[model samples]
Target: MSQPIALSSEVPATCRACNVRHAGMCAVLTAAELATMARSARRTQHAPGEPLVVEDSKLTSYANVTDGVVKLSRVLRNGRQQVVGLQFAPDLLGRLFGRENLVNVEAASEVDLCRIPKDVLEQLVATNPVLKQRLLDQSLQDLDEARDWMVTLGRKDARQRVASLLLLVARRCGAPGIDDPDRVVFDLPLTRSDMADFLGLTIETVSRQISRLRHEGVVQVANHRHVVIPSLPRLETLAG
Candidate 1:
C-alpha cells in the first residue's frame, strides 16, 4: 500500500494535554499523524447513563475514553438488554471496520472521551499496520476476559462472583484505585440491579453477598456506590 500524505503541522494542545493519549489508540501514531488526527478530533463528556453508541445504528465516530467507565450491552429480541462488557480509560470505544454498531454503549459514570471521525480512524487503520495490529491485540484481550467471565458466571458461587466483580473494577481502577498498590478503591460503576443483571444473580443474592463481604471485613462501602478495598489480597482470596 502507498504511504499516507505526510503532514507537517503541530499536534493540537488538546491532544498534547490529553490524559490517555499516550496509552490510547493514538499512542502508536507518528507526530505528523497525531497532528492529522487532532485536526478533526473533539473532546466530549458524558453524564452517567448517557448513550455513546446504540445497537444497529450507523457508525460515524470513534472515541478513546479518557477517564470513566463505559458499559457495552446488546438488546435481545425481547427488547431486554444484556450487559456484555465494560470499558475503562485508554480503551478504544468503538469497533473498527464495522458499518453499524452491534451493541449499545453507555457511560457507567461521568465520562470524558476524545472523538475521532470514523473516516479518520479508518484511514489511519488502513495505512498504519501497527494500529491494525493493536486493534487485534485489544480484541484478543477482550476475548480472553470474556472466556474468564464465562467461568465466573458458570462455576463461581454468589459470594465469589460478587468478589470477582469487585476485583474486576479494582484491577482497572483509576484515581482512587491508582494510589495504593495493596488497596483498591473506586465507585461501583454498576448499581445493585445492574450488578445483578451482569452477574446473572438475583438482586437479593448480590445484596446479601455484598453485605457478607462488608461483615467479613473484605470491603468498605459508602453512599451505596463508593467501594474501598483495604486489601487486594483479601479480595482476590474471596474471588476464588
Candidate 2:
C-alpha cells in the first residue's frame, strides 16, 4: 500500500497520524516536537483479516491505527483461539518494552496504520517528558481493558457478552447521544466467527443470539455489515 503523506521540516507541522488520539497526547506536544516525530513515521494499509503481527514475531516497529480495527488473540494448545482485545482507530499496537509478541494481531477491516521505528520512537519518548508520561498513562488504560475482558469471558453469558461487546464498539466510535434518535447505528466489523471467538461462543450460538435480537425488533441489520440498535437501554440490559 502507499505510504502516508510525508512530513517535512519545510511544512513545520506534525503529521496528524503520529499523535496518540485515544489517550489525548496531541495537545501537550509542542509544534516542533510533533513535526520531529512525524518525520520518522510512515503509514501502510491492510485488507480485512490480514495478520499485522503473529505470536512471537520479532518486534520491529509500533503502529497507530488510522482507520479500521484490529484484534489481538492467542491460540491454545488444543487449537482453540481466544481474542484478548480489540484496537480501534487511533489506538497503538506493539508497545512491548522487551518482547517480540505474545499474541497475534490481525486486521478486522481494511486498515491504515502509521508506523514508527521502535528505536526512534523510544528515543522520542525518552527525550520528551510529556510523551513519556502519556505512554505510561496509555499503558495503564490498556491494562484495565484487559481486566475487563477477563470479566466478560468469565462472568457474562452469550447474550450479555455480545451486548458488552456492542456497547464497547459503540462507545468507541459512536456519535454523541447515540441513543437520542432511538437508533444506534454502527458497523459490525467482525465476522460471526470472529465475534464467537472473542466472546467464547460458538458461531451457531452467536447467530442465534443475533437473530433473536433482530426477531424481537431490538436491532435492525441495515446491511450485511451495519447494525442499528433501536433501543440502547434494552441492549444494555441484554448485555448485562
Candidate 3:
C-alpha cells in the first residue's frame, strides 16, 4: 500500500495560485468546492525514481501533478519493461474507479503533487456532473494520444520517430515566450533509454538519430537534457 506524505506548509492557500486550476480537475469546481478540495488535499513531493503507484497494488489515492513529471510503465512476466506514457504538471494521476493499479507510476523528475484520497475524489465525482464530464474528456484525450503514438511506433522510421517525439515534447512544453513559435526551448524529461522504450527503438538507434538531427542543424542540444529548436517547420517535415 502507498503511504500518505504530510501536507506541505504552502498547500491550500497555494492551491488558489496553481497554474492548472482552470485546466485541471478543479476547473469545474466553484470556490466552495475548491475550498473543500483544498481542505481534503495534501501536498506531497517525490524525488526522481520514487514510485507513486506500484504495479498491481491497491490504489488509495489520486493526485494532480503540480510540478515536474511522472512516468507510467509496466513490466512483462519476463521482466522486460516499457514506458507507456508520461504525465507532466497539471496532469491527473490514478485511475478514478479502478481498484488495483495496472502500471507503476514513478517520479521522472523532482515532483510535487496535490493528492486527494481516492474515496474523497470518488465521492466528489459521484455528486458532481461537471467534474465527471471533465474526467471523461480527459479520458478521451488520453485515448486519442495513445492511438496516435501507436501509429508513430508502427509507421515511422527511427529518425522520423525521434523527430515526432521531440515535436510532441515541444508541444507539451509550449513555446517559450519568444515572438517566434518556430524557436522553441525545452528540457527533455525522458532519458535516451526511456525514449527508446517509447519509440520501440534500441538505445543506440535513438542516440544515433538524435545526433543526426543535431548534425543537420534541426536542433541544438544545450546539454543532455535541454534542447533548442530553431525551425519548427523543418522539424515537422522531418517528423513526416
Candidate 4:
C-alpha cells in the first residue's frame, strides 16, 4: 500500500514543465485530459530500497517516474530472488487494470513519482483510445527488452553481460551534450550485490569482471558506483 504525498496543488503547470512530459504517459493526453488527470494526481517520493509495489498485493495507484530508477524483481518460494528488470525515469509503474502485482518494485535510488489514483487512470484509459494505444506500445517495448535480457543471461559470457549492462545504463542515465559519442559517464543505480542479482552472477564475480574491464581500459571507474566509458563502440564490441 503506497500513499501519495502532495507536492503541489497545481498539476497542469507541473506536468507541462516535466522533463518527460512529452515522452511519458502524459504525452498522448490532451490539455483537457491532462487537467482531468491532474485533479487526482499527486507527487510522491521514495528513498532507496523503499518498496513501491509488493508482489501479490492489491494495487491502489499508478505512477510515472519523474526521476531516479526502480528495480522490478520477484522472489521464489524457497527464498531465492532475482532482479527481473530496471525502470528508468519516465517509465510507467503499476499494472493498469490488474488485480495484483506479480513483481515487487523498489526504488534503486531516491525516486520521485507522479502518482495517480487507480480509478482515475482506469477511467482515462477507458475513454481515450490514444492512451490505450500508448500503453500497448509501452508493453510491447518492455516485452522486447525482457527477451533481449533473457538472451544475455542465457548465452552471453560474464564479460559480455557486464559490458551490455554498462551500455544499457549509460544510455538510460547519461547526461546530454557530450559532443563525442565514444565517451559516456553515468552512475550505477544498483549496488554490486544488486548488479549480481540483475546479471545472474555472484557478487565476487561481478567485482572481478568490473576490475578486468577497468584494467583492459574498457571503462574507468570514478568510484564504486560511477563508471566512465572511453569508447562506446569498444564497449559494444566487448558486449557481443
Cα RMSD for candidates in order: 3.2, 5.4, 5.8, 5.3
Which lDDT tens digits does candidate 1 get at residues 113-176?
Answer: 9898999989998989988887888889889999999999999999999999999998887334
Using all chains and alpha carbons, the TM-scores for the candidates as numbered come to 0.91, 0.85, 0.91, 0.91
Instruction: Please list the C-alpha lDDT of all candidates, in the order they appear.
Output: 0.86, 0.76, 0.84, 0.86
Clashes of each: 0, 0, 0, 0
Candidate 3 lDDT, tens digit per residue, 102-207? 8899888788899988988898889888888888888888899899889899998999999999998887764664787688888888888889988999999999
Note the residue pairs that clash in candidate 2: none
Runs with alpha carbons beyond 4 Å of true place in candidate 1? 1-10, 174-180
lDDT of 1 at 107: 94
Candidate 1: lDDT over CA atoms?
0.86
The positional error of residue 89 in candidate 4, measured at the CA in angstroms, is 1.4
TM-score of 4: 0.91
User: lDDT at 214 for candidate 2?
Assistant: 84
lDDT of 2: 0.76
**lDDT (tens digit, per residue) of candidate 2 on 138-226:** 78988997898888899988888878888777766654344385457788878999999888899999888888888888777766578
> Considering summed lDDT, which 10 consecutive residues are worst modelled in model 3?
1-10
